[model samples]
Target chain A: MPIPSPTVITAATLDLRGRPVFVRSTGTTDGPALILLHGLPTSSWLWRRCLPDLAEALPGWRIIAPDLPGYGRSAPRPGAGPRHLGGWLHALLTTLGVDRFALVGHDLGGLVALTDAVARTGRLGGTPHPARTGGPQLERLLLLNTTIYPAPLLVLGLLPSIVPPFADLSLVWLGRGGAARDDDRRKGYVVGMRQLLAPGTVVEAVEWAEYARPYGPIAGWREARRSLRALAWQAPFVLRCLAHLGDLTLPTRLIWSRHDPFFPLAVAERLRRAIPGAEPMIHIIEGAAHFPQEDQPAEVARLIAEFLREPR
Target chain B: MPTHTPVRYVLTSHVEEHGGRPAAATHAEIFEQVALADSFGFDALWLAEHHFGAQAGMVSQPLLVALAAATRTRRINVGTSLIVLPLHHPLMLAEQLSTLNLLTEGRLSIGFGSGSAPFEFAGFDAPFDGERRHPRFREALEVIERAWTGEPFSHEGTNFQIGEVRLVPRPTRPLREFAWLGAMSEQTAAMAGEFGYGLQLPRGQSADHYAAPIGAFRAALRDTWGPDAPERLAIARCVYVGTDDETAIAEAGPSIRRFYEHSKGYDKTKPTPAAPELIERLHFIVGGPEKCAREIAAFVAATGISHLSIQPIWEGLEHGQAIASLRRFGAEVMPRAEALIGAERAAGVAGQD
Candidate 1:
């Protein structure tokens, strides 16, 4: 039996903090909000498979997935650091008039969410920042395949420091198109994205094209390199915010990919122990590499729904 | 009389190396053998896991090797003959097995055992005490079964203090069907039956050694799951087929002796038997097609096993010779053995009438 394709995602651009931030959304706007944040090297397209299902599962809740400041169709913001990305999320939520919401973050987006949560709860070991004053009330937090400790980020972070241009250059080279056409460039980016999935996963051509579209041009690479450079530069501050993870008071849950080479189960284990209010076990998604959303979309959506529907 | 059951042939390997062969080459040969088994219509390929012993078996992670085999073959099922359960965290093992099952499209089977090597347990920093081992194994298996349910569960056991956790990518099928317990003792056999898992009888033991355990296993299954419950029993045997009995012994005799010599070095306390008595005790089935078939039929009828896992390759055996034995067994011995079992079953039914 053939499985039906996921529901089509609706995309639009919203002006947040003087920059054009692209958002992919579904469900009613007036309902309680559920914001999804994508990580590095990806945009709102990361949530394409899970968005509609999430919307269907929640029924009345608004599901909003936005590209990080410098990814996909969103215009890159100059001088934005890792912590600044968290501030950018607050600004995006305020601009969207989302006062109370649940947040789900993956990869680097998870770092951004943790930073924001820490800052909001005034746990950053300093005077509370202005972004914490009137931000959206975070009801539930979900983190997927992300790291709080600095050890896991050392490879990606230190590579740039050790060999200044080696990381981005290789990515750009591997992401180079065979031909001058835009479709060829998209296919080239698809090749790069293929490395992030579990072996033997059969992805559709159209879906691959959608995921690779944002990185199809030289401008996309420029934004991606900018994001990477910012992350590499702000590693210390990110670690500082992560250190305050024990201070987070929100109801948190971790859904991790078991085979994720970048952020292994050990990282999730640490994070689960760090968070005081975290659910006892780190829900492990098997048969997936870095991206569980792509490898097990229905399961991801179902887990999200199950978590969100739990009585507070 | 034993119940009539159709037989399944599985190619089992310890991935043993000899002749100063490199470990990489041994693995390459095993994969080639896996492809051969797949093409030759064998039911499954099972690999053994051994830690810190490259001579006995180089494969420390049999599930990874099974995953490699699963990817290479189209139809053959891949499995671990026994994964040392107590050495690994159950949640992690469950996740890995679940991943392998999904990647293979439900063609993954697993055999669990509380390992026999005290040194290996010490190496893993696990409790090697006999009293703690059984309880730890039971706790780990229980945790794994609950984790496969795709629902939030918690366990506060003697060995594990797990909080609310759920497994993802859920299970593709009922995991019990793919589970096997490697049992040598009557207690362990009863545990296997209680857990509703297939029972795998260990190799290198005589038929008399297995009789009590087999009886206990059947009784446990009948008492726990009812009389009509399905029984999946498997036994391993060292087999080699040549032109005839004399030639077979001449070719395999020295290699088999060397294999036992290497095994004896692992434990010096047990008295070592001479070559021929050791061969008889281990039940090495070496001969031409007709003789091998007759013995295999007799062994199957005696043990009432539905699956026959054959170890045709051993240390010091040439790869080509092992392949030839495999080809001959699949082509000649298997059919003849089936015919013999069928005749015996028919005669049993005739006697009953």
Candidate 2:
């Protein structure tokens, strides 16, 4: 008859320009906001394992996990692009009455977080310094397994894939799971998952369904297509964000996976070196691939919470 | 002897399979108990790892349990009571511990055992004989320590051959891994002391059995590290306090006996003294709160080991039963135990004068 009490996580939605943003939150309402963002093909649920611990670690902080548009429960708009994604997220947070908050983002979510920071700093093509250029005061930031700045060749390859015919084919081939020769429809998603998840780790069927659900339909694929196109065109803007990365004048820690397929340890090391700050500790998560957040949530949460709690 | 050191309490849990009870249920209870221990301000919490036994222990992976406890509690140090190190690849173990250390904010402590169960070792396809175990544990410990250094190193021992390997996501502090060894004899204790590991001693042994190893370790520690250094040793005891001594015996004796016998069938490490006289002599704290406090205080004074780990969960001990005793120990026993130890210290100081 003995069982641990369930953690109290409230699922709610916010209206941003007529589109609803799905969010799961915990801790006190008036506490300092801590926004958690998830990467592509995964939604706010990816942060599920870390949320409870995060809530435990920072009792006075509000942990907000929102499903970006077209990801989980959020409705994707027709014209929403990568540029609009950050704006939409900022608007959603503002609507929630969160003005200043710490941002923790993973993978593509990390890229989105950078864009959001850069846009706020108003340094599209301006001289930037961490101390001088900033809109809202960023209390802290944690970037995981993401590189806002990419090698030109990497971007060049992705650039062609985002073009019309290629983008359409790429959407089918890369979205949900991936393109398959028809053994199992779920196999495409499984293959993608295998690449993302550490070997010897098992994901329950239900959990896989939650991640693959978004890419199951034609509408989902269309939304992914638009998100991709946005990413491809916003290359220059992303580079700008990368340029003014020092505009983030707060304590930041980059937690990266050593074996990440897309952005390996070298990418995180380069980013860590380039990031101008007195308080940046680059930690490499061992034995994890692209999604260390999901692979080792406790370790990921531990590093971030410790950095946040530690005096700078 | 000076009773100046304030005895610190730690909670140890071994979720034994109770009469057809599910393993999952036992695991759930343990997590809750650990969280409560953390909130109650216990100094630390340690876990029991078992494998391939018929309902002896439900938790086979203490590292996984430590990870779970880290998420649940904020301040409590999480450690394994004894991880049978011989069964695992040293590099893999090192990687796991290093990553866990980073996660726990350097609050991770490791305890290694030369595994005693042949079947359990066989399950992992590892060499399980006594002849091989000592060598394996020593070699494995060497590799684990080297891996924590975060430096590219190689080992060319008799058992292992590797070339220029460095662990990634290394421990934050290079060349350091906080560790404990639940060693059984003076030789092992000396090794543990020489290597700067905290020595962990379990209960159910003869009262005299401990002092020898501790003394040997102290001497070895002094020889290796210098006389000014402090020795850290943690002792585990079986404890249950009832309203009165008679009630305590009636309530806890049978369960304690069952626990020892069940243990005897497995874990061929140390022989436990279960005779009534020996049990009393070994000082299992089964009595009223006042008597229990005095016993614990006396034991602390004699041993000079400040850290006390109490096994609240055992074979035939229900979850609620353990909780009741735990509450009484914290609320009633700890304060009195401290007061008694203080009085002893005062008496010693006055006698010296």
Candidate 3:
């Protein structure tokens, strides 16, 4: 059954221990809320294709997409990075009045959501608190193409800022997938992703005409850029937190694109070995590159539904 | 002087984020603010362009065009208060502005300014020599204007060296009749006169200070370009209007004073009474409609300002206060000033007859 037109509700940025954070909900309010966290350089618009199906099949599900502080629509917190992100997500979910529900995260969101599960466990006094024994007993931990050891990226920073500025540049070029590289198209990605820190396909949906509405000028984009760059430097702490994921007893599933240029299949295999009591099913999306959600939304959605239906 | 028809008040945006205003001030808020200004009868809105700041003030070309996208649904004329001419090659600026003009249905004003901010000039690696910047600005302006003429042209000047280039998506008008030279010095004012362009007074300067520049332009036009030169002059000032003196003084005085005081060469942090002088000057039109009318009249008497661009909003000023102030300027203050202009124009006609 086709779901009715989606309803979008924008929530004001809440003070999470003095951090500015916001949440946006699409679909029904009474449904089980799936807190969808996006990756670097994109917003909830990354999930545009999968949302309709999730909304249709899981009529009891409410899709909660929050731009993490320093990404998308959310304002940045004074201190935000991979290590502190899980706790922040926990606080954000609680503030939004969401209780126990399955958490589905992708890319950066997956790491954040799993970390948040541990933090939430501690908050709810669940067994094996990350600070105490570490990790949590989440209902289900869903992950997309994400890295296990965030260390290698940090060591690359040993190079001077000028030399390795092209490090991320190479990644971006790969992400472009050889689209017609005109000034508009090139600047669209740079200004949208690097400057605004909130660029996504939603720009295509809205038409680029008034896209400037969400972003006033380069100044706003630059501010977002500065904060994102600072966040990129916090990779050491992110690697330190890897030990905590091992303590997670939750049934976890990892979905990855076989040909992901950023996180190879080898990294996903390492993640499977690291996690405790991991689920048997791992979906390796073929042909799709970094974002299988965009390239293979239907197949990914089907796999997710199948995974969720398996008996505990 | 006020005109026969009521003067329409303009609120310039410049997409600028100041001390109190952060870069993250939302677009939803910006759009709503413009709409509020329009409903209250603001005649025009302007956005500025800038590349880098501790806070990125503005970040793109077609700055006016982007702002117009947010506001084209409304009635007010949308434009760049002044796009820095030195930073962009003329051909690029010409193409962007022309497309913007065509898109906005002639609801555009082409404002060209010599790059002012030292930081902006340095960021672009453009020459920061103030004496040389004006010539470059003028050269770029010549190229831009020629491209807008809808006729193929070529020009080589001190800074700009564009060869036979015709602008695409040309505007309906062969030339933008509303071209403005954003003049900060007497030399620039004279250049505007020599080039047959309208004069745009700098934002922070008082009307009294403008007297010399305006005079120099008129004198130069008469001496070299001949007295037959068409008069096209405009002035921009920071202004705030209220229902009464107490209300205006209480609401807008601090913010407006802080703005000018923060401006280079006029630091309020020093022990100076710049605010008091500004309030008393012909430049700032504050208070009730009648009082504002009087101030404008005094300004016209002091300097023959035909077009006035008044900034009625600052970062911390409440939206309601700005709306009330703009409404008063449009409905009451404008008519009184227009009547004054009508009287002056009539007197001139009588003298001719």
Candidate 4:
């Protein structure tokens, strides 16, 4: 007997604090909620596989994957960096009526989730914010292949600080090139994205197209450039949030791909040690690169489910 | 026109001792047999889960064995003849099976049973009382099904209290599509039907003994899921095919007797009646191709089973002999049996028309 494919995924745009936030969601809305945040250059579409499977695995729970502001279908908040994005996420969740839920983030999204978690802990600069009082409570936090401490070699971290104009020009070139005329350039961009996955992992052409779709337009490149530039300014605040990670009391699990070139396993190790009660919470998935969700979605899903199901 | 329900032949194994060989050797032979079965176009290969006594069976985790078998052969669906559900946590089981499903690219089937062995439950430190066991099994099944839905669910049951949690990686497909309920009682068979799962009849039982459960299962299935609901009833039987009846008996008779003797020895409470004729009639299907085919057709005709899960290898049987038996069964017995079944069904349809 063959297993049936997952439920139909519903995509919608929500007006969060007057910004059009594009979201892809599945499962029942009334169940316990799980929100998925995708990393840089990718949209909620990063969780195309994870959403349906996670929703199916966790019936009754609402599984929401949102294109973070400035990425995918969401309109870019011109000056919003990681900190601002984190605040925006809280507002988005609050607007969606998700009072309490688990959060999973990858890459830049991980930084955002961590920022949100730190802010919620009332440990950000040792001062409690108003949002901490009545905001959506994070039941659990799962980070994948993301970094907290700034590394000069960090692609997202380095792009804005070192070569902002060059990065901007490259994005424009990659975005503006027509599909038929610049097939090689589009293929090169897809190949670059494929490099983020484990070597030899066969990603279908159509899937690559979905990943590249957002970046096909000038708006996508403009949003990507803005996010990159904003990260350079958000560095100090993100580091400060990182300093207060020890104060976080919520359950945290770190899943890192062993061969991630940008953020190595050492980054996960550091975060694991910094967070309270997270000593035994780190899992290293082998045979995967930066995008473990794409390289090994099953393992990623298993780890997430296992960690979430663990008694709080 | 009435359509014929084609009987699917699946090879099953307990991974039992073969001539005092090591457990590793037995596992290797099972994989080899699995490859052979796959090559011969068997519908699936099911492995039984057992614990404690090494001589009784080596397989404690049928899913792991199934995974190994799945990797070794392509196209053949691998399954647990029955995983002892009450002993393991349902969430963990769901996760592992889901991983197996993904790894195998969805060539996986599962048979779940509330195991009968008291010692097996004792080893796992689980409750063995029928009163507790039955409910726990039922609750676990409920949890597993809910987990497969990839939806967040909370369960506060008699045996388990699960907080809001969902199964990860979600199953490639709904696990129920490939799930079977291994029923030892008419009540369980009815429950399998009520749940809309396939029903797997146990081995070493008479056709008369199985009739009630089969009837209950089909009736419940029709009543609950409508008449169009698939009657995926599978029966496990000891089957061996040879060039002639004399050759078949000479090769398989002693091993067949020893198999029953070992089974009786394990329980001690059950009668150790290993009369060759009675065993031949009820348990073993050892004969030449023609005879094996005829018996298989008759059994299918009588029981109305959609699948036949055959144990071609037994304790003390040579691995080569088992392979040869499987070869003959695949090349001769299977096609002949299928032809006979088709003819019988066609005749029945003609009579109706």
Candidate 5:
């Protein structure tokens, strides 16, 4: 059934850990909350494809998505790396009075969510705790194309770049990449997404343009580059996130893309067992790759709706 | 995975004799500057190589001055900005550098340039016309390197004719001295790359003007040298960091304007057209700590050059004030700028697919 367009979506910049973090929210005023987070080379735009379906299928379920500090229109706070953003995420949720919510994370966002969960759980004595006391309550956890094992490519690519002499070369490296003109950068991002998604995926030009805004003429690209380099340079935070990989004990689900190159089906299966007490039910979206949310949005949306209705 | 070479914080001394300080006091002050810089972890310290400029405390005998400096400072690298290659015989200069290297434990570097002042060329009985200076400078560099090898070699190039003669005392690290060419034009910059020589860009040019030379060097590196030939890519800047922006400008403004106005002996060119537009683009990274960090980060982001050699003293700015600026940059500005750059780089990689 085609989802109705009665859903309301609005955007705002909220004070998040002292940086102006841009947020996109949906659903009625008083409703169960769900916070969606995106991964690399994308912003809140990643959630646009699935929001209509989610809002129509589950009315009154508040959906909140933020363009992680430095990702989208958010004013990047100081040092928004992997170790840092999760704390900012917690601060954002606390500021919104979002004490309890279902958390869904993809790629780096997934790692950040898991970090947030472990941190909150660690603070609340590992049990169902009152929200007013402290920290957000994670009712259910969901992972998609998320980083679990420190994949050699991800870990190794950033390793030497953070070391002393090489660490100093980060600006040179970023400058080279950022030198691409705005149009060329836009085209590059689209070409990159094609390699990451299912082959022959027809991404509309308008959609691509929306994603390309950050890599623009001057100010936008500089802002994006500054924010991005800050996160990539945080090696210590990457280590901390990797250390807490096995602590997600919430009622969890892992819906993965069948052809995902970054995290294969086998990796997803391993994650089912790796989330300590998760015993996650894994669903595979067939016509997708690293980004099932984009390549097969309908299937992803259906899987999410079904998962939300499951008996706890 | 990638790693970087060490980014150097070199100190440049124009040796402007502030307020009639005795020449001995000025020389002592230069040595004291080197000692202070060595303690603060500066990569290399250099005094300008100007001659016949009585007002400027130019170190005409650079190797001798460096030899003297090496005695007081344990670690700071000592060198001269430009030692007019045509003024001295290449073999004798090579021999002196070899001896200085031995004395300094291989801590000496030399920046060789074709003398620009026609009068200085006339004083040395060398040609004052265009093209004559550079060919002599270039040929001298070639002969110097060939002679330093300590192997019997004969060179029969124009302006130089030497028999198969090997020196008795060779340099400790022959052919290892950091030899750079001061590139003021595209040809020079590209030549620096093609000949595998380090580049010392003329001081005070804005970042926007650096692209052509950097690009030219890179192209030469790829096509001719097969390496980014510069042993170090050094650019000079005038910097002043204070507790705040207004104060920094207020403190550094007059001397800087004086530098543009009267410091003609520092560079061979007509005193920099420090016109209103040019003055607006002064190489002074003048501001408070955070503001300086932001400006410097932007500069690095624009130009990927590695070594930044800064002149903190001169044109009536006192020695004590120069020390404060250096300390502020070394202890406060650089660290904060590094943190900002690191975070920006980290965020950039994370944002990439």
Candidate 6:
């Protein structure tokens, strides 16, 4: 039987190396800081819509939603690609004095956030940056709308040097015109994001306006391209660090949006083979796309909150 | 962009009283007046700062003025005409501006300046090296911007070292307002142009003095920087409008004198006393709606100025008269001015076709 979890929601922005990174926190700040990294073209704003519900179920954890570079209010990275990307994430958390966290990645943010966690693992062990070692040491890994393929097999292409304008005209074409759409199915999206052992019962709306608010003028298409291109440099680190996935022995959850355009569900079994002892928690949402937060938000939040509450 | 609801008048205010008006009293008065400006249909209001005065009540603080302006008005965009940058760290300014932006829910503009007055920098230990001020001002701006986005940063340069300083409580929107550099000289104006920031030209400079800077700004924006460069360019000019020419002249004359007198710190050459016609012709905006509108249009065309900040309330003008004048500007002047600039922008966009 699925266990029930509580949900919470809050909105805020944090500074990341002189950049304004907008964040949406779900759950309590006391239990653990779950830095939920958002995927391509979307921002921490995506979590906002479901934050209130997710917050309630995860009573003691703080859920953070930060607008990664070149998305929402966060400007482009001062330097390009994975090296600076990992450093910036480390800098962002370090600036906040958050020592340890349970790293969760969705789509692009998942890959980047995970890579940074692994790169800074030494720093998290009292090496160079002393303050980084004290808190939660990447206790668990939650990957939603993600692709962990090692090389040329990755689906999405990377961020380009010269991106075409009007890249986002498709989202508008897709009919997400700031008005709430498809009210009925959101419950499932919420259930997935909760990390409790038993999924919490939640209303369809997850702080509706908060998550939608940060998507200014739709730079997601451009951000997706950039984030994917970023993987070229980031993938090696990911492959290397993720190589240590079996060694850590932490519970790894893969909440896959089955209809995701980028990551094929057929790869799930392959993923299990790649990371030994992966302990995969497969969540296949029927009608969701690459961005489960936008496509199936409530369920994603519910699954995350429920997963976090489970006994290891 | 929201619909422009016929803004006819423009007003500019500053804590000009040199000895720094008692913060509490000034705060109450500014807010009270600004709220009234919103209700009364004023288009825009600007607040500027000058530091350290023996008696003239120098209101050296820019962030404080922005805060007061935020609480005082809604609908009207409040701006800092020039926040003397060298006097304060840019990171602190960024945080203050971001907080003020949140308070206003996004109606804040940060106007930056490299302190010109030797006395103003004396207290802060900043040298009066005019040559160094421009570079220092640019670097300081970078530091501030860096702090706005994230954790502590270390920037090593010839003059300043920004080390491990983080700016918390960032604004809801990052770099929303147009960041303008107050350019009293061509060099500084060119620097602002190079950086793709807006330019706030001084009130008294002629079209020729402005031509080089404005030209530099446009060339840099179009050729050097991309088209997405800061789209707003504005200059400061003294403006007062009323019914017939005489009525307008009657309201503005004495106030113009005081404004000019106060501005003497920057322009040491005393303004020569002139006849009424000369004052109306060159220095002030006076007369009926048609006459004022024509002057504004001509000024925009002559300078290719996309925006202008006008001072409607003077030191001696009655508050009632000022409000009435603001109403006139909002209803009459703004339409004409916007149309003129709009046409210019449209034509420019058309030429792109």
Among these predictions, the greatest DockQ belongs to: 6
User: After superposition on all CA atoms, what RMSD does each candidate show versus the true structure?
Assistant: 22.3, 21.1, 27.7, 20.9, 24.4, 20.5
Tell me the tens digit of each residue's lDDT in model 5 across A92-148: 777887767888898768877766666555542433323435666678888887764
**Estimated TM-score for each candidate:** 0.53, 0.51, 0.47, 0.54, 0.50, 0.50
Off by over 4 Å in 6: A1-312, B1-10, B17-29, B40-44, B54-58, B223-225, B257-275, B278-282, B336-353
Candidate 5 CAPRI assessment class: incorrect
Candidate 1 docks with a DockQ of 0.01
TM-score of 3: 0.47
lDDT of 6 by residue, B204-259 (tens): 66666688877776665544233434445677766677887787876677666655
Instruction: Please name the candidate that would achieve the greatest lDDT relative to the true structure.
Output: 1
Model 1's CAPRI class? Answer: incorrect
- The residue pairs found clashing in candidate 1 are none
The lDDT values for all models are 0.79, 0.72, 0.60, 0.79, 0.69, 0.60
Candidate 4 ranges beyond 4 A from true positions: A1-312, B265-278
Better candidate by DockQ, 3 or 6:
6
- Model 4, B186-249: lDDT tens per residue? 9999988866689999887777789999999988776544465666889999888889998888
* Collision pairs in model 2: A177-A188, A177-A189, B149-B175
Real contacts retained, model 4: 0.00
Candidate 1: list runs displaced more than 4 Å.
Answer: A1-312, B1-4, B265-277
State in Å the error of residue A38, model 6: 24
Share of reference contacts found in each model: 0.00, 0.00, 0.00, 0.00, 0.00, 0.00
> In candidate 1, residue B298 scores what lDDT?
91
lDDT string for model 3 (B155-233, tens) is 5567867666657875555342556677768988887765556677766556678888899787755443335445667
The sequence of per-residue lDDT tens digits that candidate 2 reaches over residues B214-274 is: 9877776655434544567888898887787777777787777666566545444666555
lDDT of 3 by residue, A116-174 (tens): 65444443333433324422224777788766465434433332122222234434434
